[model samples]
Target: MDDSIVFHGPLGELYSQVKAGKIKTALQGSHTRPCKFWTAMKILSGIKNAVVITHGPGGCAYGVKQAYKLTNCRNSGAPYEPVVSTNMDETKIVYGGEKELRSAIREVDGKYQPAVIFVATSCAAGIIGDNVDAIVDKARPEIKAEIMPIHCEGFAGEYRSGFDLVFRQIVKLMDRPTPERQRQLARSVNIVGSKLGPERTEVDTDVKELVRLIEGMGARIHSIIAGNCTLEEIKQAASVAVNCTLCLDIGYAIGTEMRDAFGTPLNSTILPYGIAATEKWLRGAAVHLGMEREAELLIQREYAAIKAELDEARRHLEGKRAIVEGHDAVKALSIAHMLESDFKMRPVIFNFHPWSTEARQTSIDYLLETGLDPEVLITKGTLKFGKYESMQQTERELLEYLGGVDPASTVYFGSSLSFPPVPLVDLNAILNRPRFGYRGALKVAKCIKTALDYAARPRSWLTKQIVFPPNSGGLSSAQSLTSKLAQNLPDCTVYAQRRKGRCMMN
Candidate 1:
């Protein structure tokens, strides 16, 4: 029942609230939000030998199937994981769809002969109370492949809830490692909670490059949790000596669970996004595996190559204002710190998810220690894409915190989903580009430069009028001007308008 979104709060206050366990927010629009269905698709998308079955309507399943196509596993020579659905209709909802789900599983197995079959239920499936557990048990004897039912109902929680559920099931379903396997892979590590393939391979180079970095440290990547992992790889996950979470949102639970269940230590360091974070992660990971020297050498080489580029980009980025938002406060704080320390950009706001997790206190402590206190906003599970008024409120609050800032110079570094209503220096959708390590640091610098450069470009007088809107209190009256424009400009098309406290925009 705790509020999901919080605006106009200090970093310290937000941290205190999170620590005191007063910051839980329920997600809205189960169907629209990235629920368990989406999480299952993302995790199973990279597995070469798996078929995912969503026990839902055809429409629900189609979305996941379409998303699976976006993955760039072309180089891996792995066939796309088939995502099917039961296509639950009104009749199925009223009278249990257990038979339909069973049929889907059988069809997938007959067609694919996959090593494993993952079944994720939908909100409708959950409501009807299909005996999924009983079906899985009964079908195990009938089917040759391992049939694992992921108990991630759409309404169970948010995207993260599905992530956690999938990981837990993975631990239970994956074959337990033998003593020999454990010893043989003791020095190896698991990179938990990363995309299995190059979906954003064009813009996000960090995943592949991180694998290369780990291999350079004399450590093999034992498993990447659910992303791009086969049944065999997931089974061997228990053998690894340590688990490293790339991002706080997805892998924290997986790493923690692995440590608790299999005695694997977890490296819950903030993901290696910046030069400093990468060095720290590499050093820490290397020390744990007794490969510090190799890690240091690789870090030195990578840093040297990107230093000049980073410096040159920094010259253009200095004094620029930015706002960083993410699903986890820890990750957002890390980006904020990197922007301030490396690029010398001023972070006006730091928005994060509104949940109090085990890592919340640690993240808060680190933020306090760094002294880079920006206005903190908790996104109350409003996951729909495009700008929202709550986000604009945060921007206004940030403007208040800083007394005022050049709106044109400000940038946002995060996902396009739920970004502020302004020009954002977005890095989320850029495919295959590195956002971590020395090379990633250069990319960040270049992105800042590009955003600023683009902002500096001349615009029409009307455009400038819209961007700067005379004496409208920066962000406060933006909606007002937009409404007025809609009313007065009869000849011009009005794309979006606020009506009855709701946004009517296409």
Candidate 2:
């Protein structure tokens, strides 16, 4: 194995230890998929009385509900029952919870009469030997409406792995063959690999663009795998001639399975992240479908439009530096590539949790190809919530390791805000923004340009010694200082407010 092909960060360390010699690289923790949540939200939003049952322990169910709420689905006052297993206690774990789960499902089914009910399992359910599949099998005959069993156990693998498991379950339920048992439409394709919901306008935009792109190639979308898809639309997936798998992690499994089960060929490609990558991805898919000419024309149009927008952004961000931290290694790598290749900017570091050898290898390859050193990347920082004292000891150790770099140089991603003074970027915002495809790339480039320009504007408190008083009204003194310094600069408000504290921006 080439050593240069492996990139190690905090999460990668655990993965490397776990896999040992078995695998080359891995990703750490589970990265949430935006499309899956969006799909579920879209379905729930449409149905007046729908219930989403997470068939696992408290934490797993909590994560799912939290993801839903974070995506801004709950604010709509949607009539949906977000239920979880209350009986998932020791007894339920030791023996088996099939009876309890079945009862829970039936009760929710009867009470809600939901258009669709989704039962998702967790790591505990998987480890304790719960037969979720059998439970779904037994309950299917009795349920009046569609009861989709999603096997998204956290222990099943990583976030992408969970997506694959859940998506496969959805595919199994939806892709039943037509009576004629024929591929009904040659011009139709199934769009796969969105784990987040349509609540994010960007996700909605991407799906729509995909539909337009496919349709422009004289191919219609038979069904989108999950993003903004309904129960009925999912059932129509079998009619498609091909499955276009984007977001490689989530789509690979389902696409391959659909190809095998329905004879629908799978077109696997990296997601369109930047202008060039987007065009390449679109062209690749179109070529596979024998629509290269049409794809080229569409690409030319998008490329020209995006170039004009990016040119303006590049003027502002040309030589700036940035750091990115997220679980999606592919997206991170692609962003780094875009920063260098398109914007002529420098990405000082791109952090990821290593979980799989393949993930590590892929990221390493991307960084190497882009001429980035793996050493500059930092990963494995302590993620916690609550008072600063809890992280005091770890913070000291981290500060020592970080050395010359200012403490504020660190970037925080997740919900927890326990860390000491660090410039935080809400991971949700980074992932949710319309930052995919041609137009998306230009929009993101502009956003990055704005961020870099803001960063360069001199601020009083660059040191991490500035502390935020608990619930100090709006902006803290540090924030005020930063804001005052950057007030004269254009687009500096975003940075000024963001640097003040770890407030959720987006």
Candidate 3:
């Protein structure tokens, strides 16, 4: 409802609608949920030597700070970066808090002395017209760190918009490449849009193998765009011979900006999830760097090492049925194809999106090429179970297609964003490591096997279990409020009205 990029509600109508140019592009849900400030702060978090100062109240800062702490906990054991807030109270809001912001910056710099200071303006600052740029300019000379002002109000746009603004601010950090550094471009490459996780680093999964594949071809990883890299590494990004973007969400924007600014060639292709895709991706990068032979050799070697395990896992995963859902349409599709091809699983429904009709068409073409033609259902962002009623019809249709097999028996692959009525293999839940490359393929196969084993329970077992307490009785206003508030009731029903309404509708 909130500016949908594309909508493909299962079946032949999907093909028709896609062809009709009804949906263009893809990714996360409504842009109205108000997370722009948090998004910007997360991006700034990846900059190792940067301290983010939010020009807003304690509430906004607290949320962003928590997000920082959580993401940092997931990162490569890096110490949490300093995030200071002006804690703008009502008095400061009415009179103005520019002086408070200035003081916060000074205090933060004096304490952290980070190489770069990122000033993140919140919706309050934007509404009050706090000129962050002027304040940064005024404080630039006094602070030893370079100051960067990010104008990302919570109402600015969505997560993607925050990424754009953050990257724009990061661009100012690029130092002009010296003639000597320009020569470094021949063997140097920049990894754009790489992110770190709590349990394992992305480089350990996607970038690690990628680095192996590229460096084997005589290329050096000059920088990982927004990952755990130093300010110096980021500045060197401008001098890299080419840039590779693994995740398309922010990768596309970062690659485009770097290409436009530094004239660095970019490989914004889909991430290498499966064997074939990884081969294609590595070859693409190798060709640009004139290391096609090296790429092929590396691919062959890695494939040989993991092929046995993949095949064994495939034996357990074959004939499995599943539904794939997540933010990136292309990534979801890639995973779907991997399931269909190597694992020999049947993917009945795919929820993904592409920003352009052309991109969607291309994705569809790729799926077809891989012999996967599943029912497509595109969605964005976090899957809000609040819209469960609307999903019921689709759920029934899918269940019927499964010949009444217990929904619990089906496999689900996605982030925490999906709530399929089956054993869900929440990809996002895997915190310790990422799913990528040949190793990742084997890991997924093992997870699918585990999910199938766990889901072999009787279907009625789940339905027979009680949700609300014994006396909760068909929820109605007439029911005494005290009865509904019984201590034994499930904590899941915080929204009594919405949940009851959805239950009745179903």
Writing each residue's lDDT as its tens digit, candidate 1 over 168-228 gives 6778765566899888987898888774553443334577678888987778888776666
How far residue 299's Cα lies from its native spot in candidate 3, in Å, is 0.6
**Candidate 2, 78-181: lDDT as tens digits:** 33456555447788888878888888888888887876787766666767878877887889889887777665555455434545565666666665667553
Per lDDT, the best of the predicted structures is: 1
Candidate 1 has a TM-score of 0.76
Model 3 is weakest, by summed lDDT over 10 consecutive residues, at: 487-496
TM-score of each model, in listed order: 0.76, 0.67, 0.76
Per-model CA lDDT versus the true structure: 0.65, 0.54, 0.63
Stretches of candidate 1 off by over 4 Å are 1-9, 17-32, 69-78, 195-204, 315-321, 325-331, 350-386, 389-424, 429-432, 449-456, 459-506
Task: Evaluate model 3: give its TM-score.
Answer: 0.76
Global local distance difference test of model 2 = 0.54
**lDDT of candidate 1 at residue 13, scale 0 to 100:** 74
